[model samples]
Target: MNGASLATGQRSLGDPSVTFPLWPPQLRGCPETSTAEIAYPVEVDYAYEDVDTALFAQAPGPDLARWAPLLPPLHAPTLGEGGTPLLELDGLPGVYLKDESRNPTWSHKDRLNRVTVSAAVGAGAPGVVVASSGNHGASAAAYAARAGLPAIVLASAEAPPAVQSFVRAYGAKVLTMPAEDRWPLMRRIKVLTMPAEDRWPLMRRIVDRFGYHPVSNLTVTHTGHPFGAEGYKTIAYELFAQLGRVPAAVFTPTGYAEMLYGVWKGFAELRRLGVAETAPPMYACEPAVGAPHARALATGTPAAIVELGPTGAYGIACTVGGHRGVRAVRDSGGEAVPVTDDELRAAQELLARQGLWQELSGAAGLAGYRRLGREFDGPVVCVGTSSGFKDLETGRERVRLLEDVDVDVSLDDLLRATDA
Candidate 1:
């Protein structure tokens, strides 16, 4: 970890007064907010006044470590995450896409895993555990592998098969389970009482009390790793530097809204430090099948849960609302926009046509922007969360709805096959 890190300690987002030690990174979410069906997460705080304002004079680094003064203690090695390109779309006027698929493991989750896995190494844990749909688990496994720690990922059996394979490639044990069962299994060890074969050998190794760091949520609602979202602060820093000014609006693909809040926090820090006069409007883009954050905003609740419907944009199709998300949307004067699968598909196709193939859900920000249909006072940045390759239908299957057919070895046949 950098000695220049200005991190003071952890504070519950629910109650800023409730603070905890910065060391031995908080694996469990805030206890103060724990309730029957909701719980708020904790966020790391830093001595911003102590940060050298001159550091911003130079361009940001390719690694997140350069901004260490504003982030949590990074105890894990870097996987070359962060510093993704801010591409200005040719046809979209001032609209830019902060394409996060450029990160290691090809998703924004790499930013988070880099911080969360480091917490395990800092806490002296033997390994890390996480429950993910696809991008999260794959990124966690890669980071844990880099940290030389064993990782057990509880992944949904329904997630893209390619992503499950990606997790296993990092030497992590993948325990495929129902989407609903993944979180419960990650939080409790009662399932270990099942027969040896039924419970599986890997399940016995998961004893959180025995010093395994959980990189995911451990509460009734979602309160992921304390330091995870901190890693995402780099996105805001990068955007500010890339645009040479704060954007008027930022549309983020919100699963738990961890990344969205992280980005908002970064901009907020800048505003507090007098670097910027205002923070951008933060939009939480969710799958239309279930926009719990939107429901929470409408109901005036800290968080709310929703019944999920079938949608291909499963990456951000979370059933439960996260407080971090509500805070980001509310604090930034942003709206929670839900886009249908058709909207997502349109955005995905358009990006692909523009030579940027993004995951179905990764196009949510652009989809949401189009759905909102408003002009911004300044530049608008729509976040692209991951690669289209991570979609349920593989890259080869996406443009092809039928089985492959062999064409005859003639110029005429080739032309006929492609309808040239």
Candidate 2:
């Protein structure tokens, strides 16, 4: 079957009857609810068929559009976002690294933006708006620019300087505000309401008033963008093609778990298409502080929100966990693994020694695996989602210059100074 063989639509994760078209700007929340504050999870649906293996086996093209058959319609511009290398560490026999830092914006968010911006284009929106602590804003701004649309980013004042610079570099209008104030501004450009007590009301305003497409989660529970996660499916396809089959385990760094869910769905689709016999167990790795997914799994709930503690791995320190992540972990017999900042830092250092400078949060998968300390039956893959350059702590080291070098110093004296 070709790319056009499938029809894409949206279905509410909480209520099946509450459905809408994914292309046009649809209801941000379930229409059945009287409370505008109630946000529901929504997902994209597509018709399935047995297609030839060649569809995935083909050498991956530069952009995410290469997997058009499985993704939403391509209504936006391309920036060579996909086809990142699957690297192996010499010391780790069964472990492989899905290095996603190679994406256009140097993070996995590029994959998400490629599809979400396309959604904006499909709906004929003038521009895009997003609320991100870092990588998401940078990717959205870059993709929106590529799609010939103005971009607006609502970022926290606490956002890393590098990420703020990246967003501005893409020419997106960057508004630094209190985290609570971001969602309200997302609704009406002029109406910057006092920080609302909840997130859902402002989410509705963002769609109903601003006519701007949202690339990230708006729900109290993170349903994520129906089209955005489709971009991450390419990572699964690439892994299968590169490994010749699905690995035994796939470890992913989880915040809202959008990428984790997407990767699991991609592998499930592969199995459905008879491309592989079974999908791997997915591990959702998170910072030790506020691991909502872990709490949700333990409590037998679809989603949960937990109290957060301080963590240097800010990118993945999400307080709220999504149903998508819980489902992926449950269905695959996977577990939520929470790692300390120290563990993640060590993992990042390990990657750096291997010539892969990954963000501390992005090294979570390896940290999880190290915590697991079990022998896998076959190959295991850990996703490294971004570059170390994006981390707030990443910077040049300070070194002491031994006394200012004297012009009269001899070569032997210089050698002695160096030894000293």
Candidate 3:
């Protein structure tokens, strides 16, 4: 009946204060309790009603302004990652394409970095660093610049030049390093930069203390600010709002599985708040070369930390599992499907027919959907996570709009001859 209660759209059982950590602890495996108490720097007051609205809104949960102040003003990018058109594929039962190439950074990674940079700003770091093969680096750099924060992206020299160019364009410092050096450096950065206690106060005063902000490495799954994943929740929220119901399944291309975790968590929150009747089963589509999620799923484990193999779909290429990946698969009752490069290329062609352009890894969801579409009932949405331009260093073949031809004579000569 009160104003705050009306906005929340729920009655509070009681007002309670609780301690929260700087970051949500990663879900290792199936636990006795469905939710884990996360640790943030400060204590927050929570009510049943607060969780209710956060669950159902057409956005991800958590307040980014509170959690990540170093970010630029949060606004919807016009390119449209959040409200993607869910189109039904012809002859594919209940299959839908959730195209993400339209995003500002031309990838779904934009959603994650937007949240991650906010956290970096909140943490009072001088700059953020990341180890990325491509899309993640581009997005991280883009958001870092927007927040007026410095960024350093470590990438392999062998990576596509176009990807490298994107990082530079955003004015992020690019560090070309070997794969062995990337993770070790990232871990060191997190330890040195993050405050041991009182993370909220440090984060809150980021802008005020320093006119120019800097954030540390963004590659850490656990270290990333909570608000980063919140951006991805918007995907699910919009899907639910637009469709007027939850889909039967959602298939995503998994690297660290952050995107998958956000969507799954969003739906779970909705279901918990009585907004959604059920949660969709989440399916992860990874390259066959390094299918960590698939291996973990096969063993019924939360994640399989293994060495990564070589692959062209470098964006979703990672050896170990993040906390989100484990939780996403287990909580959704979903599985990971390994897809080959050939299969992804074919999916890309399929999307091209529908006028949706996507990168190779982005096509993995479509590949999985093609294989699993028969089993799923009702609606099935597969996310295309990036644009082809990110990997153009190999050089995509040019498409000719016209063929070479010659005219026998000029217009005046033809007219004179015809008249005569």
Which structure among the candidates has the greatest TM-score?
A: 1
lDDT of 2 by residue, 188-245 (tens): 5622222222333444555568777877767666766767777888899999998988
Candidate 1, residues 243-356, lDDT tens digits: the string is 999999999988899999999999998889988888998999999888999999999999988989999987888887789999999999999999999999999998998889
lDDT of each: 0.83, 0.81, 0.61
TM-score of each: 0.89, 0.88, 0.72
**Selected candidate, larger TM-score, 2 vs 3:** 2
Please state the error at residue 141 of candidate 1 in Å.
Answer: 0.7
lDDT string, candidate 3, 217-335, tens digits: 12212223334555677678767876778998999988767788778877876787788889999998888887877777777654466666667787787665555666678778998
Q: Candidate 2 at 200: error in angstroms?
A: 7.5
Candidate 3, 223: how far from true, in Å? 7.2
Measured by lDDT, the strongest candidate is 1
